[model samples]
Target chain A: MDWKRYLFIALIIIALFSVVIFVGKTQTPPLVIAMSMLATTLMVATPLTLGALSGVFCETSAVINIGIEGMMLAAAFFGWLAAIYMNTIFGYEPMPSLITGVVVAVLTGGIFGLLLAVLSITFKVDQIIGGTVVNMLAIGITGFLNRQLFFEKNSVFGGQVPHAPGTLPIIHLPVPKVVGGVCSLFTADGCPTFANALGKVFDQRPIAILAIVLVFVSHYVIFHTRWGLRTRAVGEHPRAADTVGINVTRVRYINVVIGGLLAGLGGAYFTLESVPSFEPLMTNGRGFIALAAMIFGNWTPIGSWAAALVFGAAQAMQINLQFFRDLIPPAWSFLQQSYIVGLTPYLLTMLILTGIVGKTVPPAADGQPYEK
Target chain B: MSENKRSFQDALSESPLVVPILAIFTSMVLGGIIIAWAGGNPVAAYIGLYQGAFGSLNALSETAVWATPYILAGLAVAFAFKGGLFNIGAEGQLALGAVAAAWVGYALPDLLGAELPRYLHLTLALGAGTLAGLIWGAIPGWLKAHTGGHEVINTIMMNYIALNMTSFLLNGVMKDPSPTNVIARTPLIAETARLGTLFAKYRVHWGFIMALVAAAIVWWLLERTTFGFEIRTVGANPDAAQYAGINVKRIITWTMAISGLLAGLAGAVEVTGLNYRHELGFSVGYGFDAIAIALLGKTHPLGVVLAALLFAAMRNGGTRMQFMTQIPVDIISVIQALILLFVAADAIIRYIYRLKASEDKLVLTRGWGG
Candidate 1:
């Protein structure tokens, strides 16, 4: 179907929101709520987009990377730790320390990616189980370290991570803000109506903006570039690519390593950009959901980011369903429940997976171990 | 069925047990090193772990209790793997089973306005749980069989739905009614639905025996029966099996349903035999852990039993290891992950042991669009 048909996310969003509306109605203006939700979903979509982009890079090179979750998680903890350590030691500069943290997170993810590449590609382990091992390591190490550093406050964990949030910066998107301010001028909320929401949508953290830009960059790289052609060739038919003098193993390894960098950037979103502190399991299964996004997007960068936006909207709706419960008729309001609200993204994932809206095939050699 | 099958004498020297045992031993040694690095005396920690798993009647009982779930869950994964499928949805199936069993146990009698007989009530509860799992598992199987959907992705998505749905039921309609109860759990089952403990002093119950019998049944089905032969054949090669006139699609669906039935039984046992109620957080990761157990056991029924027991011991011992050394119990997961890593990527093991590679390899799953 040329795969671009997978971009039919409009129906998915409407279906999901209809269910939400069916459960209950909200007192807030639905349009305003939706606009705000659109803004927030993009914010939430950033990390997932990056994670899916990472998956695209790896999977498109014929390597299955279920370890994106673990990579992001490891990056999340270490990134937060690096930033905290720097802020405490290097004169309270958020930029330098936070940058260091982001770099460390990316490095950690890359290392984990390298581990996956070696285990699955070099050693020919089952890719899924190899990824499982990385996940276990991420969880165990992060949990163990979290206890020592934050819980027990042990000196051995790491000396003195900064508790300060002000040192962190929030980068504003000047373009979105100006446009939003003009749009909001007529709204009853007195201030520019769309200004705050538009700013919220556009004024993303550096990591968030990077995630959005990378979506386009990844798309261009995968579809338009010579390197991308070779990558797709390797993923779909390793022997064919190899016959053409492309280094299959090397491409898989290097692409997967870069995939890790993207996932690490996603992880940094959790600690540095989203929240200023580290918590156990803060990634909260988003990595897995990102995999779903990648699949839903038919393994394309723009499609994946779009899918991420859908998931992000679901997440946004989840947070507000309770407040919007009043929108429901009183009898049905009883049905407006947490689990059902929480169920939006998962249900949507499964529905999209059924390929009713769109169908796309994966790269032929996606999960197979290639041996010369 | 095939000329490549080994003779008794050949099997004796080249036992399938060797690689798995070595994997376990290597993992233990690695775990010991990690324990030492964590600042605990490795020998003492091992001693404590041993004591925790088998040092006393109480510890042994606890190990058996833990093994009850592991055995069934491992069997589910192993059974699926042998059928050329990866049953990642065991977690969801188990949850559905637990919740269904709990509903049947607690709500059925009240709905009927009479206390059902023990055998009937227990049977119904167990059957309901099994049925829920079968139905749940069958969806993905049917999807895979009919529409070329991958069970791996479908199963994971199922887990999310099952878990969230379960959470809702527990918190809302099914909540325990006790005044002090703030936990998300169901009311205790009717007395008739509960499984009796083997004896007064031990926590182990009839479920442990049931687990053993389940293992034996799985072994017999896979090794002795025609259906088992067909499943294995289809798993080995669907096209070849089809050419041989075997119904591959039906086998896949039935295989998944039965695998899910076994996993659901694990959840049923937990409710009727041990917990007596379904709690929101209980049995959270047992299904995922079963993947490691299945691989560790080499996907053989007997292997599954032994592997489940070993995993149970580690899990049970983890408590004591933590109490003594204050090392986080997550180390067990670490050891498990390491074991799976070595076993999954067996080249390192082969290189270390200088063993020849076998022509026949395990097929865990053929991921996405395969």
Candidate 2:
């Protein structure tokens, strides 16, 4: 009900209208476009929300983690590796592989968080530098591992790497007759296609749905619980918390560990949910985007989740905007220049940070180490 | 004579070289153990790494080839440290510089409608890169001084703009339209504009010498001059520097510009001296790695040179270790990470060794919000 939130949503609706008009004028099917946008939005939003949730834990503890990208990349690789090992060694299904990926990712995140906390808090090192170091290490290690394991000239996975340009697995589900009628209209344009309809019900790919659920659970823990209160206190004011008998360092360490676990899980989304195998730098800069979402959300868990959705939708919009390729012109087509179009989220971040025009304030201790 | 000898011995113990050497030895031993644990023959891998990095003249030349840009970029980060700003956008700045250098190197002769002399064309190309970096560096400094925007965020954001724009330009406009070329890169510079190779038998060139000279100049600038004093004063306390009549904003801007200029030089050297053309992925992560180099070097210009050489050797040798022993290049990353971990959290190193706490702590960044 906040004016700012309303304004943001209104801006999104206006942008959507302009896109729809551009598509309609260009002779694209409206129903198809609408359904594709819906599907893409949900798909992109899943990982982003998970990342934002992880970022909330760190930001609330006053640690601005710029290493989320690295964490995600490393986690993605290890998750896939763990999955492959489990399938080969223990004869597990894809479900077990996904679980293994999440578990390994959490452990990886915890280790990295420990290193970051030790450097920034224990040694009183600069948090940004420490975060950057972790990021570099992640990139180097991931790049090296990717070259060694994945880049080989082999028929690995027997060539079934999901998301690498192929038919998506579709499962049928029950829907109301009216919704089915609407879906029928959509299917005419390749939208409410049999696959799309099937994707919507029993449509629960466990990882993506689990990630969404984790977001709400993480938000609840950060906002409502005693642990959450102490965590927020340590981030906001270590001295004040110390005066009150909250063990600030211990809280920071615990939260950092938990934050890492979330980041690790978020990383696994790249490998377990999107693709069957890992790619070098697959998480790319989403981790940094998540941090930006956390900040843009004003250090609150739910707000950050919403912000991640906004960023994720921006990504989805870039793809859905392709329906207007004919209207947008060949040279400046959002499809051809999707990389440029992809910059919308970062540009949005800059605008938000430049202050609502001047008052961009982070949490009081967002990047400060607990001195005591 | 005994007292004099003791004092001389004390001076030697306090020498800058001791710290870096110790750091290197410790890292190497730790790397060896990691390699063993990772199921590799540490002895053979070490030999291969050493051989590939410095076993022969060609290896020595390649080592210098990698070290040239590392030294310049390391200086970029180190110089910024003196001004108390972390120049994280060196990667972007370096990319912009390389593109500018390549454009000038290749297009200027065509623009002028004449074949320019090697010296003139090379200087112009190199200068274009430096100027490009100066502009990139100045923006964040100006923003920090006037608008209170954090440089960390801005610099990181600028990196995206620079890299993406560079990609766009290379893929679209600047992309070499020659039928044989398909990758996103510019046309090669004319032979006249390239910095001549030093040995004629190796890829090593004048850039190595230039880097060393730049290091010397940086050392003199930080340790000897009035301008350096102003930079240090502002870095230590901008408020105090303002009280002392130093124009803090101007100094921050100049410091950033100089830092950018050095980073630009790193890019320019790679193009004109090493790579001969500006490709999208040519520079890789040298700018980011420079931060680690600067930290390991203790932010001294000499320290930067030494650290850069060590980093250069590891990178140069890593390929051989992987090729010969089948160990992943990531193992080297583990070693580098451990080094950074130990250096950044010196307490861990200190606790392991039971050493007394050191007096000088490396404080590179201002508090996060600022």
Candidate 3:
């Protein structure tokens, strides 16, 4: 199974890199284009990676959480709002204000997670319906407040939208040094072009790097910890877990809240990291796509991240096609239509779900409320 | 006489409509508080909303026009619920249906090189739209039946794929191509394909009546037919249905196709009976909103019609409410969400009102892999 997963990942990576190189050779160096596309893919995949992790945490606890979209949306708005108030009203520095926004976003997601727990666990509502409620409520509340706070003529700030504090700074990596060391084995003069291309690939914003780091951390935490064992026990057979004194409810609550925090960080990536402003439905259905990735990955943190990368590559292809439109070959004129390129990820999701690898099985007691 | 009066009272209290009515009332009250908090007079805003929805003949006509699509889309969702399937792809299906209708309306005459009779042309356009929607919906259903793929995820995947396909078609071959037109839309449909208006001054047309007739037909199909019985049996308990000699897989696929057909009809009517051409961004969110409508209506055909009208009124009234009080029309969505919340989680309402829980509980679909 592990070998199969690795092979699938390798095949997809090779295919995507080949396409990038082919497209790039027409205008620039193939390696440089391939490296840049890889970087873009990782950047685009960050939110999806985080969102899939969120799904993994909640579903592994047997509390189906389809409200990842709503949680991320609320966090994005509140985080952006917090940053604006910190800079404008409190007169804080840009760095500190942005940090404050991230914190607020995490807390907003946690609060909503708690709301979901109460509705599903305490009130005994259908989990799917509960998720729908959170989504609709988030859309309504955010849309209403966005208009009232920024757009209304007689509202706060006198109808002028406040200037965004600014996006997070990119963390420059020591990629050139690393690449130069590797290049010295083959060439007397280290390949500056190769090093520079690799450098661009490694240089990323803080949250983007954090998403990668979190994947390995979540993998270790979920598979090699006492808490993880309890989570699995409760999700699989709650009565047995309760009989064994595992405190099923407490484990579920903690896991679901953790999921919310991850989704919140994903939300922050939208407004605080990528763009410094908010837009209606800014997440743009990425949360649902994350769920698809989660299922495709069989609900593992590492596996889900790999699936997210595949989706990211598909999206990056769409973006790259737009940029390199003139370089497209005459025989491949259909690729010039960006919408056709946009269909890749969704079509891929369908194919994968239809048992391309094998049937994916969820946890035994998933979506069932424990009466005890 | 005394016994009959007491029974009537009991019936009113115990009716399935009780929860929906209370949910609507509670949502409006909460909506008012939100409006007041946002700095507008709640009373004035609500009064304006009322006037805009039903105060004049024009307002009523507008409400009916909006209700037509809501009714069809709502039925699409409700019908799927009856078959234990969640058809979230209605939005995409509806979009494709509109595209198909528009294509047939504007392109068929040229392809045939002759003008068709009005009735034949109109039927062909509408039929094309319905068939497109049916195919779009059936793919996911077939996959769900054959492959253990969850319909929820597959339907969502279908939505993105369909939307992108529509965008490609509209931007390329289907572009209106007028010198001044820069938008992605179809050319104006042939005059022969258009539906007649009910009145000279109002936008309300024969499509509204068609929606009502469709509802009645759906009711008959669900209640009085052997196929309906099979669908209901499979929905309630697939194992039992299989034991009783019903082909559960086929029923599941057909149910989704029928649901998609209704949703597609909604889009076709909008193109032929309302908008003369299909355009991007013309009918967004109706499919999503239909989910709330289905829940509010308790998944009943008659109840769906009422819920559709209620939603239509709120949406129609939002503009007037905004004009009068500067309140954003998004409040209607908030209220709709609240209503859905209360309906889905009736325990809160029961707790507040001190009522006993009812026996009939909604099951929706089973979780993934069930």
The docking quality of candidate 2, as DockQ, is 0.47
Better of 1 and 2 by TM-score: 1
Would you list the rank order by lDDT, best first?
Answer: 3, 1, 2
Candidate number of the best TM-score:
3
The alpha-carbon deviation from the true structure for residue B158 of candidate 2, after best TM-score superposition, in angstroms, is 2.5
lDDT of 1 by residue, B1-370 (tens): 3444445434532667767777777888998887777666778777888999999999999999999999999999999888888888898999999999999999999999999999999999999989988988888887778766678777877888898899889998999999999999999999999999998989999999999999999999998999999999878888899999999889999899999999999999999999999999786778668988899888998888998999999999989987887666777877887788787877777668766665566777667765
The better-scoring model by DockQ among 1 and 3 is 3
- Total clashes, candidate 1? 7
**CA error at residue A217 for candidate 1, angstroms:** 1.2
Q: After superposition, how far is residue A314 of candidate 1 from its true place, in Å?
A: 1.7
Better lDDT candidate (1, 3): 3
TM per candidate: 0.92, 0.88, 0.96
Deviating ranges (above 4 Å) for candidate 2:
A9-17, A29-35, A90-92, A150-207, A330-335, B1-19, B242-247
Model 2 clashing-pair count:
1
User: Best by DockQ, which number?
Assistant: 3
Q: How good is the docking of model 3, by CAPRI class?
A: medium
Per-prediction share of native contacts kept = 0.57, 0.42, 0.73
User: Between candidates 1 and 3, which one is better according to TM-score?
Assistant: 3
Ten residues in sequence with the least summed lDDT for candidate 3 chain A: A1-10
DockQ of each: 0.52, 0.47, 0.72
